[model samples]
Target chain A: MNKHKITGFQYFTVFFFLLNSFIPFLGFHKITMISNQDALFSIIIGSILMIGFTFLIKRLYFYLPNKTLFEKIKFLFPKGFFFILGILFLLSSCILLFVTQEFTSFIHFYLLPEVHQFLITLPFLLLIFYFLRKEQEVIFRTSEICFYFYILFFIISMFGILPQSNFLKIKPLFSTSISSILRSSLYFFLSFPLPLFLLLYFPKNSLKRKEGGQKTWIKSILFSGIFLFVTLFLILSSLGVQLTNLYKNPLMVTYQKISFLNILERVEATLSFSYVLLYFFPMVLLIYLLKELILYAFSLSPNYEDLVLLLLLIGNLLGNQFFSFHTNFYFSISIFLAVFLIFLSFYSFLKKE
Target chain B: MKKTKLLFIFTLLLLFTGCSSYTELNKLGIVSLLGIDYKDEEYHLYINVVEGEQDDGSLQKEYITYDATGESIDEALHFLYLKSNKKIYLSHMDVLVLSEDVINSKLQEIINYLLNHPEIRNNFELVELSSPMNILFEEKIDSKEISDLIQMNQEYMGTSFSVTFEHFLEDILIDKNSYLPLISFDKNLEINGISLLKNLKILDTLSTEETVLFNLLQNNINQAIYKNTTIVKNETNIEIKKNQITFHLKTEINKNSNKFKENLQKDLRKILIYYQDQDYDLLKLKYKMKQNHLSSLEDSNVLFPKTSLKFDIKISYTNSYLERRISK
Candidate 1:
């Protein structure tokens, strides 16, 4: 409970949680629903929905003031129901962990090919371990430290890409069909439910300054939503709609083109750094969820070593299958994630006893 | 207090480790543009190196030429890379200048090298020069201010086709067709406009007049010359504007032969009729007469420029036999 209660500024890294959903999907998902331009329109709708969903979650703390979405649902559901839902959520978090590791490795190959897998994996494992032992506030502050660099990079990338931003490629506007974009948006909304799942573990201190929490949460979500939309837009513009559809990883392809004046080249390194920051926090969040789920399932008495065992095993299992067949994993995981999200959404809203 | 030391050590370690991870400039030679030609039954790879400037402005270009015998373009490049001490960095390259000889003899090889090279970008300009490749950079050709003028003349005036590497690749790979700009350097090495490409290979290329006719088939011409539109006392120049190119098409099926005859004769007649019927030449002359008030050339304003656009018809036949000739 002491660890659960400690929330800090870095806790906002959960915003990046949603971004991971799409990033991994790009590398592995073979069933590209749309071309790059339409895919972008899909991503924009996703980012916007995510932004609104965060706002809705924040509004729940004040506007729907009686109980948290999960708590309200839990109170209504039978005891057995919560257990099944918890198990489902646990399974989803494990997959999230797998995807996070895979995407991080993808970045490693392009950005720092020289870096060994153990070295990159080691820091992340430590980050998860550090957050697992610390109180929520410490995790939040650590996330806050990481978040500042994340933001600094985000701002720098924005400015850096401006000159390269070919506006001509953005036109002819109102081109792609609206129905296609809405369907793509549903895919966007699928990844969004992760941060909403975190509301269950929020501390009492976080709830006290409800309005302040609302503002901070909303701003971060909006910023990240904009980040995702811009990322999609940049991918679409740099690699036209046709080629974007053909390529599996549009972001990597686009960033490979970040040459300014031929002197300051290779922004892929910068992008890789930024990408790790995005996945690292979400991954830690997933690890935290795993610890909580395991501790509850076995009644393992909140021991850190218990998690170390489970995670080391899980991370290795994930790391082993990381590059095996990305497309296959993506399809299986996306469908599973969709079903899990629908289950959670129904469970959260239905348990209002 | 302990965290401060921990943070310092981490930062110091990053700095130390970062040194080894960096991609060294000395080991990488920056390729600015590439040209591939065929000679002696081998692939000739030309890489234009910008060999970046030092702290001082004392920087000079270092051009590297790599040639090898290979079954494929990538094999040739790998061979070139193997022979060199430094890695060839190609992402910086902007212009891909193809020689006429290579474009004619081995276009497929040149295209494969450009399209497949991971270091090469799609947005780079694809220029074809008639003058030998070495003469392209003879003078420091930097007319940065008049970029629009240079592009229009190069791309539109049909001295060459303005094709980006990406567009060229995209058209050739996907659409199965592409056109590129043609270049010809004068005695002073001044590069001129483009020529068209029919597939991955050059088509029957267009001269200035044929280029006009070929380009007219596709509408979107901002300027054109109406050659011999007017035969006046001083022989005035005709600058064109507000032009439209509409085809008067008639497709007649010749049942006897079971073939389709496209009578482009209607379109030709329409064009000739329009030229002969319009007396805009006389109207322009009247207007100029009024503006000048018949005051000779001395009193004209610098800004007010005018030219008479007219038509002249000469009916003569070279192929007609005297025995078969009729009075006109």
Candidate 2:
């Protein structure tokens, strides 16, 4: 096995954690608002759509097993087009800075109310900078280590939150119009599997064993989809549709209700910290992707990689100070990236390069 | 050179640690209970702060009541901060008391404030008081005693139910009405019954007996003693038909099952009729209808009063230790 390549399980952990982190912050409230009690159905349909999309991407991966999506785009598209693609990747990476700002705002509002936003953002960005300086395999290995704790905390939290869940609140399902449910499902698709386009940046050769990697990817999607479905179900049932729509972070609010045998209470802050940990994985990955794009786009030597990363972190910190991105902004950008990925995959397949 | 760089990095890490936001424990006036009242176009705030350590090593936990008034809750809280020597910490608060005037006029503001406040958790119990400051002043009741009283009454007598902030908000949002356990002071703090609220105002108050039936209908009772009978279990099921809603209450009692069943059915019907006359969805019948997808009627509020309500009660006698032996 190649030392630099990651194991299929590590890849699974990376995608699983990435898929799970995005929903509670971005997709959950919007979907619940649109479909109401039928949000669970939206997740079900959305997962199937996501699985189908993953299969198509898997086929595309098999067609060009040795090259990353960027290399393949460069191989097929014109030189100018590849530069445009590089710029798009750069823009996408920059858009992810809003997530850093959001993370800061969430911590400032919920955990450390008295702490300055810069205090939170500075250390957070520094941590990301340190992680980005490491090899890509290190990030995957870190995700593997964190995935166990994520699952353990999730199971422990469920033990406390499940008893409070009232299934009656999920009643009258399918009462929402089909169009509404479909629209919500589209939002889920945009929020979840669409972002998995980032994973395609790694070539098939980047995995230790590419044969089983597709199965791992599909399994991870299924697992993360089930986790999100259960979470949305619990939020709706425990909070009801009206309350679910009322709060910005309904899942965190639901976390406040967790009490294990009435002995352990107020573990929301701890659970939310775990959520912040999950957010770190994607941030590091985005910065790494940005570095790669900057190097490839400018045809720069490898020595400037660290300098490019430093510039990206500073740029993100400055960008966060000026702009505030909401769910619509994320949805629009995600849709754009998903469409771009789909277009690239089909063009590569049709060109047979 | 590398060691120097590492030392500098560690120093930067020390700077990032939450020293800026840190406050010593002795500097915090831990608020255990908060009360709000509206009078003279101002908000009256009362907070019970837990302070003072014991002579022994163990904490003594003495309670101090602080009162302040302002045009808004935040301003009143600011005034409260000025009076208290330590920083007012509200995360540890166990209960919040709202006066009748505050509930009548400033309930929306109160809800918004609680919902938006970073320190205030929705897990704290919310209670209604006629004169919250007067009761806090005269009774000297802390949050623990008040929460315990409500919990005990809810579990045993079923004449009162504990309503947390989350539960209250969910009820209002889902059912368009909610209820709070009404607390009063007469020589000592006592739970009177419950105050019904709708459209951000107190509609009416339920008596102790009526509250028992209310808890029964809502399936909130764990174990209640009613009319010398120990109600071990209660399961309420609602069936909605075309123009009538039916309640099937299955109950288990330790003794006097037959007589208690008759009184319970009659009392439950009477309470339902009284609330129906006022067009109040006391039992959340409309919410249940909507949940069951049977809310076809355009104006459930207008037709609910005229709609027929039927009660089907099933009672089972649970044998005591001696009775079980005798039967065997």
Candidate 3:
């Protein structure tokens, strides 16, 4: 299979991957810390701000057809500049993979206490590794399948959770200080849609006719935005502000509470399975991007599966080893890396032909 | 074709086969009910483990109560784990009974343990135990029945309301004032009333009548019969069907209808206002406040009696009940 072009649904699958990876993991605690009751408002504002950036990336994507932005950097920029940018991109992807592994470790801590962290993550990493090696269509199709599972879990969450929510917990809305709202909104802009920047690396022409257009960005943003909004609102209303801050993973906390008539207990374990399944797509995509970056940086041959394997193994080991030290600057570093990628995207678009 | 065949087998093996350790059922101590009592600066943990099997190819549940004491609930559980030959599993735990002493000063400690333990499911119903642990855990008394009683109270009883660990956590996070259905042992188990807790300490308890009123304020009452006085005592059966209330009042007095309803409202209002003045928001009235009342959340340190609740009294006299009373 030539395995180049992906349909609009596949493109949306990428959006779902980005959405599932971040919402409950990254934004839950940070939003509560910054805005408290004003979180939903701040998220809306932050999403609007992020959509503006995605629009700019869309403009840049169409600027040069049949070429990935990374390829554009290689073709247009000087050799030294391309080499440095490629290495930086690979480093950022590794950092992100490590950060995601920290959340995986949490799942181990809470759900699989009897199992070793390595054992918990090993199968997950291996599955993603297999996904990374498949034809692009297979990867896309698999993600499209997992997208349905995500929707199923999402519906379960809605029916399982919404009635239990105390709407009064969302009181004093729009009452947070201006500084707090702004700070949270800024946090949202920095973390979310940053990972979406990785989509820029996919060969633009790989998108089938009618894919990778204005509608793609709009649909991606709308789906992700509505999902984020509902999930965040449910967390805030269900857990409230104080308890939201108390749990490291409030979404998991909310999931564990999904019992109807005392029979539907332990749904978190099931939902966690869905979450880990959905997370594989983005993780594999990031690893694939990192491998390509490394190849482009070193002028290596295409047959470098060993290199991807080496990178993933070393990344997983280091992620588990330096777990505690990574927590302090995890968000800040992600934001910085995202901002850097955006800058590169804009520079490629703006440079004289 | 050869490559595709190999890949298919590989994927199937990975997907369907084993990756981690799996424990057999007989090798685990499955806890069905847990009781915590704090005394003399130490935490006492009691667990009711369901044990044994039958020859009928079915498992027979035998409640075996085990007790352990330590500096913390975690330490206590650690001791329990070590003492047992089988690994203790709490996933099937249905009820958590906390002694009054445990509720008073050790609630924070208990909550911390509950939050940390992955084995402890959040659906456990919490109740108060005034009886000694030894008596409560006696082999004669079925420990499992207590949890069933709690379920009954939550689903059917009108005079009390039950709080799950999830609800308690949510309430504590929001206001630190909440209520739990109280179960007491007086030779036999009984749903006493509801305990009003502030900052996890038992501030006071509502009588059975008061709990019904509390349920009314919370809109949690399904069907309840309440007796209150208005120059004469009347037993009224109240049922809330689809947001509308239908009450059958049986009064034996030739009293003015408006005054009788007014007295009922007065009694309800008095209890609510009294609790509000004490800053024990048992009804979560603060939670029900609109956006304009948000200032109360910020100035929570200052105790201001909530006076926003209004009562509109409507009465319908049933001809049959009226005639029966008149004949009497």
Candidate 4:
């Protein structure tokens, strides 16, 4: 096995992009639909709850300092560990398929309207397979390099979009019911930071400096939460509640309105390409997570890595073709996965492995 | 190893060619303007395409117009596509004109088509056309000329306003009402006024003078002439109470400030009452009341026409330097 560990900053970038990749495409639309004008408040409350849950995960990490989540499960429930692994394996596969479908649909709608869907999906799957052939450290390093470009384009797009926003569009605050806001907050909690639980596949000792891993985790969650909050606020203000709810991709439509100095018009595609960059890291990481899950379940050695990756590539292609999943389906599965992971963490804590 | 390297290079070259969606620029008919008209169960479509050619080692640009008619907009576009040698491209279209009939009967269908079409952008200027075929077929007048006319008039006279597809849709969705600038060809193409719309249908056309007043009430004026007095700035605010709505209009004028202020206040009141009598919430008073949380009635439509009106008009003299009149 390749022996390479990641730095605290690499871990930070990986978790940051992982938590934020879904906001522009899926999270913002669902949250806005549920809470209407009160989506901003939902994001805020959701961030607080996410931070609290991160603390619980941080506490669980102390019980087994250098053990991956799979190892801990094996140690805690030796008899029923395979059953738990089976559930995780199914959940990860489902998420992988859903994300692949969404990415393909986004590419079809925005970038390549005339291209066939399978052609669009084939290249991405091959890319994932190519990347999976390497050690997991490559994914983190890739995120570190892409993070700077992501920030630069993000700031430029914000400058283009901020001036055109009308604050009056967000008027009549507190119009939605308290229950609706809380329910939307729960959706936000489940959709955004809950995916960070997947990072437990990399144990604490995977970092070169293990002293401040928790601090890094909290920082990434905060940064991602603030990013989501600002995006929702801008979308609501620029495209009022009615228009925001009308379009399927409100953020991209809002990006269509970005005009800088009237000379830099029609740069929406260039700006929105940053979303593709943000989405790539999480996708690669999820594939890596699935690879680890399969190896642990089947008790296979590292020699079978290439074969496993090839099988996964074919599986993703077939899954995307045969299944038509909606955003709500993905959200429901995410909630289920988060609950299962939470139960696993508590079981490990009780057993104190 | 050499053969493997060559195969990899060939595969990379294939990827660089843009795969299945690739098309040559010469094969596209770039549309810069589109016009729609409905008559006798047929939809008429007019398009202006930008064509370029090389003449004596220099490229020259030309604007061409094509017309087609069918039972539906898509069918009309399909026929146009068949007529043209190149594929129709609409991403760069600048202006879309609709006749009064199209605005009256086919707006919802048009909106659904525009929203569903992927190649259409929302930045194009929208206008209502009078004698659309006459103006559309005028070879000398292209999209640039039409866009420039509306923009220049908006900046200089304030008799017209430029409405984009995005804002038009938003207004309809939020308030169920909107307006489009009216363009007509009388001797030449001229922006006459604005056409008022309610629930996706044209209700009436406001005269140039009434359009200036409407712009004033909505605080969308840069410079306009009201009663021969030049208005340079306008700041309007609407406040809603239990049983009344108040308009706080602050204006800056260049000349004849006092007389212009009185005339403007009188005309403003007359126009408000006129619209109120017509039961047309021209100023979006119903939306404003709901936005301000001032409407207690479950059905706010009943309260809109019955509410009392109040006006506070403030005028400041901008052209008078040193507090002394230069003329008069």
What is the CAPRI rating of model 4's predicted complex?
A: acceptable
Q: Give lDDT tens digits, candidate 2, residues B1-328.
A: 7578557656776799678789999778999888999999999999988887655757777887888999999999999998998899999889999989999999988999999999888889999986546667545588999999999999988989999998899888876589999988767888889999988799999988788888888888888878777889999887887589888889888885557877888898898898898878887777676677766324566667778989899998888899889979
Return whichever of 2 and 4 wins on DockQ.
Answer: 2
lDDT of 4 by residue, A127-238 (tens): 7776777788888888888889888988897898899999898876777789989988888887653356677777777778554367887898789888878887888889
Question: For every model in order, what is the iRMS?
Answer: 13.7, 1.3, 4.1, 2.9
Which 10 consecutive residues of model 2 chain B have the lowest summed lDDT? B294-303
lDDT of 3 by residue, B1-328 (tens): 7589558646754653334566788888888778899999999998888777656768776767788999988789899987787789988777888988989988987898788877776777887876787677774356557767766654444567767887788788778877788887767888878888898799998887787666655656545555532222235444322222333444433333556566667877788668767877665544544234434454533423534545654544434567789989
Put down candidate 3 lDDT per residue, A1-353, tens digits, no spaces: 24346888888877667655665346478777878888887778877877787766665576566776566776667666676675667565555555567656676666777776666666566666666666656777777888888888889887888877988677768777889998888777665544566676776678787676657766776687778789888987887778887777888888877887878776787887666754565666777777667776667876786566567656765666564435436466656666666676677676754
Per-residue C-alpha lDDT of model 2 across residues A73-123, encoded as one tens digit per residue: 777776665666766775676567767877887888788999988888887
TM-score winner, 1 or 2: 2
TM-scores, chain B, all models: 0.52, 0.90, 0.78, 0.90
- Assess each prediction's global lDDT (C-alpha) against the native: 0.51, 0.81, 0.69, 0.80
- State TM-scores per candidate: 0.62, 0.92, 0.85, 0.92
Which CAPRI quality tier does the interface of model 2 achieve? medium
**Model 4's DockQ?**
0.45
Measured with DockQ on alpha carbons, how good is candidate 1? 0.06
Residue A352 shift from truth in candidate 2, angstroms: 3.8
Instruction: Specify the highest-DockQ model's number.
Output: 2
Write out the backbone clash pairs for model 4: none
